[model samples]
Target: MLAKPAMAAIWVNQYTGEVMGKYDRPAVFKVASAAHRRLFGKSKAEGAFGAITGKLAIGITTIALLMIIISGLIVWRPSKGHVRNKFKISITKGTYKFLYDFHCVGGAVSALIITVCILTGLNWSFGWYRKLLYSTFGTEVAETTSHKTPAENFPAWDYAYSKLSSEYPDKEIRMYQNEADIVVGGCGNQQATDTYKINPANGEVSSVTTYEDKAESNHIKGWIYSLHVGSWLGWLTKIIYLVCVLIGAVLPITGYYLWIKRLILKKCHSA
Candidate 1:
């Protein structure tokens, strides 16, 4: 889906963390965002605040996708001693045979990537699913925010950023003062961010939590985009994902045709 690829276009420099196009999203990204996450611009916030229906939609669609994949596998069960032929694609066949081969072969090939995409895509839409993923993977979701108010004076955000930026020159730094302290995050790869808590009054950096300090869930969350877009292994996986995703998109159309044709034939026979 366009949404999967669009999420990959965050445009952050891994070196400087210069978030390019932070204010302006391209037209494709906007359209995909509107369709996939925002329900074509119905939901207000992308997160936990606004859209109940979007979450429901994701959950329902994910279930349906699971069913589709399972049923496809069922239908694609290879005949005895013919597993090799089942994967062979031939355009020379008639339209029905070609479509059937394409559907089965494509589904079989891309099933793993589609499963990974579905699983990775779930965290954005459902908190419960996220929690289940975390717990199942032997991690607890911890709140990174502290509610206590900082000093009356605003935290020394500039000083903190300077301190972190110099220490980790290769990293991209983001800093903000929450209720409790000045929180600074420095990251090299997008996933492995180090978090620093600074004192508001003294501008002192108190604690630094590195990526290694994080749990498996945190690491997995960071890899979600890469895994979903099939970029984890560079172009090799991307090509595989591209083929599989396109096939996935086409499966429903072919499936619907078969279902309708079957119905028509049954009705004709009865008549």
Candidate 2:
């Protein structure tokens, strides 16, 4: 619930005079997000324990994951000068050979991409990490936002729609009254959308903010978000990320097989 804002967006066909609306997210998304971020559904803030409420659980998992990646890479490191051997997947050798090679080689490659996703992701899992990013990048921390009611010149539905339609052409725009902004969707990254405030009296739209306009810490954070989700290079990185994620999903099962196999071998030797 911390990061999940359940807001429905309505779409209007200006020319046809038809309204289309639906839930912005799927029903399972709420539970999944809670499980992923907060873990126990406790942290009210994004901060993982504040020392974050709910994030402590995820922070522990994050630390463990970082350790796993580091250890995994060290184990995968080649001995001697046989670097070529490390990259091989021996299909004709045998089933075990093929599985082991795939697990080792695929996992080694997947680890780099997953490591990037994890490090960038940890920025949100802890407060100090975020500050570290700010200081490292020579940027000041962003100020916390507070809600304010929209001004009395609140944009009329038709008035705001007319202006926004042109401003973000072919994009889905949704106006939020309490937040006093129009969120323009489909800017590539989920967090990369642009927001604008409108003055209905004169049909004027003012800049609320856009990801591209962000500077210093916030701008770096946008980069972090893009890198985490693999949107920086558009489709190419996204495709690589997808393949790595799929391989990553298979890693644990392969690891378990190897582990059990080793245990049985040890038992046989002991007997």
Candidate 3:
């Protein structure tokens, strides 16, 4: 369900104003569809795969970009004066230029992915995506049943935090409770309360990053959720994620327009 690669095909076609020959579209869609089936399952594939894949693609691409810039610099150094010299710039300089584009232009064009990631993440913060992911991942996700509230409930967030801390005795707790009916977990070998959430009435300690109590060790989801939501960074972190999401949406739209303009220019020149 990689949307980056999917969008790339669409962009390539649109930029050239030429559809892929029949064989190519089927091949591309086939691979995409298969991946979707594997990751999200047949239900997601048959229904909203396009939208889901498109959104997820943007996020995956955006994350890769941070490293791609560094990798590009390492790989494409032209000062050694190999084939890259035909571009008539030093390897280091050319590599830098290319990386700058890879960072800026590539990020700009793929901002849609970030946008989708943020929005979908926000959506996932709700019960809907949680259920979807749980089912997709084959985790035993229980639906919140309408049970009577016990009059003898402890302070949900505080008690849950204590319980998690006592139970794990290793990982730090963060964001024990938020506006939504969900708990979230976070990073650090040492304890940090900022990355957790606690359910008040039932002592349901759900981590946005983890539905149940994790071990003393951190999981990838725990780390990624911390990084993506900026829970690790404080209020400034949330602000940064918000800003990045807004800017990410801008990048893809602008890139689309830029590509269109270039297409126009190319057509005019040919004419």
TM-score of each: 0.70, 0.75, 0.33
For model 1, what is the alpha-carbon lDDT of residue 216?
Answer: 68
lDDT of each: 0.67, 0.69, 0.45
lDDT score at residue 183, model 3, on the 0-100 scale:
30
**Which candidate, 1 or 3, would have the higher lDDT against the true structure?**
1
Backbone clashes in model 2, listed as residue pairs: 43-54, 48-52, 49-52, 49-53
Error of 2 at 212 (Å): 5.9
Residue-by-residue lDDT tens digits, candidate 3, 76-96: 444554644423323365544
Query: Which parts of model 3 are misplaced by more than 4 Å?
Result: 1-214, 217-221
Q: Considering TM-score, which of the candidate structures 1 and 3 is the better prediction for this target?
A: 1
Model 1 segments more than 4 A misplaced: 1-22, 41-48, 142-170, 177-190, 198-206, 224-226, 234-236, 263-271
TM-score result, candidate 1: 0.70
Q: Which ranges of candidate 2 are over 4 A from the true structure?
A: 1-20, 40-54, 79-81, 93-95, 144-157, 167-197, 206-213
lDDT at 152, model 2: 37
lDDT of 3: 0.45
Give the best candidate by TM-score: 2
